[model samples]
Target: MRSPRRGNAFEQAEAAFKAATKKNEPMPKAPVTPPAGKEMVSLRLDRDVLAHFQDDGPGWQARINAALRAAAGLDPA
Candidate 1:
């Protein structure tokens, strides 16, 4: 087995990496597709929309979700 590498291990590794990357292969990377039904994020609202929801009280977010679904014809009911 080879002993520890001398100076510029990164250079050797980079050369090996470049050689490995030259193969005839699809990119071994995570695919870019729309996310499944999980892993969502929420954002704080702008002042005006926050105020509207705030005045509308507890169910306001649900109402907004329903409204959006209705607009998109996704059957909010």
Candidate 2:
């Protein structure tokens, strides 16, 4: 097999695991309301905050969401 094809297969497997785990987990029992279809909004945070997130690379947005959830007294995991 080609090298690129092998890399793609590994990526596909990783994605599959993520989806499977997400599906296997029990759903939160908060009356089933979710914040979907929300528009992307920009905010001006402090330089340190921005730097902290940028250093995390990809999925930084998800980290931000988790932080927001925690701030709102909601469970992030």
Candidate 3:
């Protein structure tokens, strides 16, 4: 059965082209050398914990990272 019309012609054509050209590509291998700087990660913190860092407006993330580093007994680099 034909699919119901949704988006405008250009959008529909683009969607069809993407589906037709898609492939089951293998995942890329990890790099041999570790990344030089800090890596992105997701962490869940309590509301109060987040608010405490965000109170200063700017540099909240850096402050949180520093707090974590201090708690881990690492020097603030």
Candidate 4:
């Protein structure tokens, strides 16, 4: 006796095409906020200077920002 076939190639291709073209539920919108007046820029510093700031582990970037602000005579926020 011959074994029963699972599905034909055309049927499998149609099912796959339908599944691929199916639309998913839309994602919910997130709250929008105004910019905080900060702009991203590229800066180069000495290896030792960067290492000094980074040695403290976390918040090294914040520390660098604070130090720069202090050097520039700007008041802390």
For model 2, the local distance difference test gives: 0.79
Give the least accurate 10-residue stretch of model 3, judged by summed lDDT.
31-40
Which runs in model 2 stand beyond 4 Å of their true positions?
1-35
* Local distance difference test, each candidate: 0.75, 0.79, 0.90, 0.89
Cα lDDT of candidate 4 equals 0.89
Clashing pairs in 3: none
Model 3, residue 11: distance off in Å is: 26
What's model 3's TM-score? 0.51
Question: Model 4, residue 62: displacement in angstroms?
Answer: 0.8
**How do the candidates rank by lDDT, highest first?**
3, 4, 2, 1
Best by lDDT: 3
State the lDDT at 5 in candidate 3. 82
Clashing pairs in 1: none
Candidate achieving the largest TM-score? 4
Model 3 per-residue lDDT tens digits across residues 6-76: 99999999999999989978899987763578788899999999999999999899999888889898974
Q: Give the distance in Å from residue 56's predicted Cα in candidate 1 to where it truly belongs.
A: 1.9
**Which one wins by TM-score: 1 or 3?**
3
lDDT of 2 by residue, 1-77 (tens): 64545457789899889988775558678775536865578888899997798797998878987788899988845
Instruction: Score every model by TM-score.
Output: 0.37, 0.46, 0.51, 0.53
Candidates ranked, most accurate by TM-score first: 4, 3, 2, 1
Model 1: per-residue Cα lDDT over 1-77, one tens digit each: 98987559899898889998886867689877645653445877789976776697798866776776788999945
